[model samples]
Target: MTILDKYILKRYLITFAVMIMLFVPIGIMANLAEQIGKMIDNEAPVNEILIYYGNFTIYIGSLLFPIFLFLSIIFFTSKLASNTEIVAILSSGVSFARFLRPYLIGASIIAVLMFLMAMFIVPKASAGFNEFKYKYLKRGREDRVTTNIFTQLNETDFIYVSSFNPARKSGNNFTFERFNKDNQLDFKISANMIRWIEKDSTYRLTSYQKRKLRGNREIMETKRRLDTVFNFKIDDLTPVSYVAETKDLFELNQFIEDQKKKGASNINAYKLVKYKRWALPVSAFILTIIAVAVSSIKRRGGMGVNLAFGIFVAFIFIFFDKVFGTLAEQAGFSPLLAVIIPNVFFGVLALYLLQNAKR
Candidate 1:
């Protein structure tokens, strides 16, 4: 790297580290406050609370890094501008675009890192953290579905699960029912014990009973020793929300496909979530460019004014993010548009400012 590149990189890295350091304490303090109630209510021990808050800060930090990145770029670049160091470099025949080479490289690395964390790392941590919260911090727990729960698979299907011991591969009192599209009773099948057959991805129901309903009278009933293959498994009935966010992207796609097959309604939220998973990572790059473009302009009001303006611009991005997300969920707007609108708008603004900066 050239000396100028190293110089710019040093400033950017220092700003990034400073921003993270400042936010880390704020996050820890906020986590401590949240856990205070949990510690009091559940009488959680110090070590357990410490672990929980530690994970909490990491999770929050992962989400907040993009915002911090935006702030850091503004902080350092504004300093450079106000000090006329950028002017000196321009006068030295260094093109503004050439100076941006290091910044763009740094931004790309951070963006890719953010994408990897959001896609893979955050999911695993979030799963463990959520599990801990459910076990220790939750109050008035709902009885999770287990053995002997009568659950509805869909609008036209009823399942009576007598016993489903998830740990053991055995379940008793299994009944599967399906109705016609017109809501007419089609057929009912009952079984003694159902075992999940993993190799073929099917269910094995042993010692079953079949009843064919015929116009509410004179239905054929038969009993038989049977090993049958069925598509739906015991795990199919798991509440979708119980799944972790990390798994949500893949699962939501599968779910939307399954729902389409089953003719279900209201998958907008899942659609939004899926788009958001990709959108958030790319946002780091766009927001960084926007931050630099906005703050690099020389102003009489100095760094404080530029900092305030940066905060305002960041809030605008965040506000639109929430607003578009809500609209996507409620009105079924194109998830791609909902997620990308802010980036597109900010990209245009960045280009406009950068052109003026070059002039």
Candidate 2:
């Protein structure tokens, strides 16, 4: 690379580092302020508190990666424009496309780093961060499951529960049904109360009754208490809120497939997370282009004007992402499409800005 390339790339990376160093501590302090009461009330250890904040840093940083990157690019590029560095570089026989090369290279570096963090580091950190929050701050929150739960466990098996308490690993009004290949009801079990025994990996059913169908006859059995194994686990019945955020890419894909097999109601939420891992990286490129095109020209109000415009665009991008992601999770919109739409929209904006800046 030329001296110009190295100069621009160095500035790009340095500004991004400065942005993270500046914003992340502020984010941590804000989060700590909000949750400090809970931590003290729960009598959390010093070491555990430190660890929770450490994980929180990663979790929050990943969430705000795009905004940090956008602001960093705008900050540096606007300064360059204000100082006439961009004009000088362009006037020195450098084509606009050529001028963008080093910025794209720097963006590619950040994108890869962010992608790796999202795929590996962030998930582990998110798990710890959320675990600490729910354990200490939101006590008894994880124990609550949706009432009147019904789900298909497999092609031939189904389960129902009137109420479930995940903390106690117990539920009431449980029913299990099995169907034959000919679509006939083979058997069914109903229990007044059911509890999972972790040590034995079995379910204990109280006031149990079973009925089996054969040809034109039915057999019935009753028991006060019964212990048996079934295809479903406690997690399959009561998924935690941050379950998707805790899984890395491979684990997340496998989880989605497993949920699909079980006909999980929250499968779309999991699928959204999977799609976003990829979308975030692609958005790095789009945001970078937009930041450059919007800030590379000198303006009357200098860097502030450019920075304000960059922030506006950043907020719009985030708004689109969140709105579409919610639609995907709650309204059955295509997860992939929901994740990609914002990127495509902003990508077109970037191209338009770049074309205008070229002229």
Candidate 3:
């Protein structure tokens, strides 16, 4: 549009880029330092290690995207304020709302990019990042799948296991049940041990017993070992940690729907991830407005004061987000509400600050 718009938008984008470049490497180095001992002890290969860090970079960058953008806005806007650039712009017949046009444009660009990354790119990177960590860094730790697993495979069928070993694709004390439309037990199967054969895609059941309930007559069958196909797969038996984080938006929505049908215990956690995919990008707009409003005024203590305030607000936003998210996951609070509440609260604050700054 105007020369003023170009000038401000360029500074905004440049500062945002610079902030990413600075924070991503620092995050990688700090994470590497913490995990280096584990890597060395595990004798991880060089290429794998490099790839892990590469994934880590994307993971951490997406995680901290809002904070970096917030700080970048504060830094440059504070500089513009201190150097009287904003004052000159305002005096030159540019209204405060008009002054914000370039910043909003810049924010829109970042928000769209962040949304794309969150919806598509970050999930793939998160999958690799977590896969490497669990495989190498967490070797010998407890299995990702918990013991005493129970799941409903579908409307009429269910399965249970006393304990499952994901590495071996086997379980002990397995039980499978099927029910009729009237919720009557149609058939029941029990096995002392069950193992999955990957090549054949069948289950090997040892010491298996089956009972058919046929109108007060029980038909019983027993076998020492039998191979049969079940409705469930290994993934149905053992869900990995971070499974929700690994899915893109479309896949995640389908996953939430599937989990809903199965009556999953951790559906709230999955819903939270889904809601946050949208919330994180929308927060970019709110944070940009707040940052410009807060730092556009020249302060007595210069950029340090504005920076401190910006960091404080950012931490508060993160704290509220985590607290509400945990409440939703554990305390049965609404996941959608948990994700939106923090944004609403801060968005109101942003509006308040913007109104005051405009005068």
Candidate 4:
């Protein structure tokens, strides 16, 4: 790399490092202030609190990675433009595309780090962060689905319940069904109530009735109560909402496959987390290009103008991401499409801005 490339890349990395250092503590302090009372009320231990904040750094930082990259790039590049450093480098016959090489290199480095964090590091932090939040901060709040649940256990097995009580480890109007390989109903079990007997490790069903279909006849049986064992756990009836975010890349892939097998109702939500991890690295590149194009030009209003525009764009990008993510989770929108739309839009904007900046 030439001296110019070295100079630009150094500033790119240094400014980003400084930005993270400066802001993360402020974020931690603000969060601590807001949640300190909750922690005290819950009697949270000091060591756990310390570890939670450590995880908080990674969890929150990963979410805001693109925004920080955008703002830092704008801040440093605007300084270069304002001081005529960019002009000096460009005037010496460096092509506009060539001038962008160091910034791209810096972005590539950060992108790889972001990829690692998103796939592996952030998940661990997310697990810790969420565990602490739900355990202490959100005490007594509902953590799992409790009403009108249905799940396909396998190709031939299915289960449903009208309502569940986690504390009681039971459900009302529980029904279990098994089908033949040919998709014929083999047998079905219905119960007025089903409860997990923890001491005995068995499921107790009250007002139980079973009907079995034979080749030429149907067999029926009824009982006041029965004890049985099944392939799934009580918790499996409704997974905690943040389960996807807490899993690493490989684990998440396996989980999605399992959820798909079960015909999970919220499969799109898990799929979104998987797609976003892949998309995040791509976003680093898009945001970097947009930042350079927006800020690496001298303007009458100076750095403030560049920063204001950067903040606006950052908010818009986040808004689109959150909106599309919600649509995928709540509606039946394609998770892959939700991930792609915002990145594709911003990628086009980056190209347009780069062209204008070149001229």
After superposition, candidate 1 runs with Cα above 4 Å error:
45-47, 141-176, 179-185, 188-211, 214-244, 248-266
Candidate order by decreasing lDDT = 4, 3, 2, 1
The order of the candidates by TM-score, greatest first, is 4, 2, 3, 1
Q: Which scores better on TM-score, 2 or 3?
A: 2
Q: Where is the poorest 10-residue window by lDDT in model 1?
A: 237-246
Question: lDDT by residue for model 2 over 231-349, one digit each (tens)?
Answer: 88866775875688899989998878877877677678888998899888888899999999999999899989988898888789879988999999779999999988888888889
lDDT of 3 by residue, 17-53 (tens): 9999988998888888999999999998999999998
Better of 3 and 4 by lDDT: 4
lDDT of each: 0.74, 0.89, 0.92, 0.94
Count steric clashes of candidate 1. 0
Q: How far is candidate 2 from the true structure (C-alpha RMSD, Å)?
A: 2.2
- Could you tell me which residue pairs clash in candidate 4? none
Write down the TM-score of every candidate.
0.74, 0.93, 0.91, 0.95
When 2 and 4 are scored with TM-score, the better candidate is 4
Winning model by TM-score: 4
Clashes per prediction? 0, 0, 0, 0
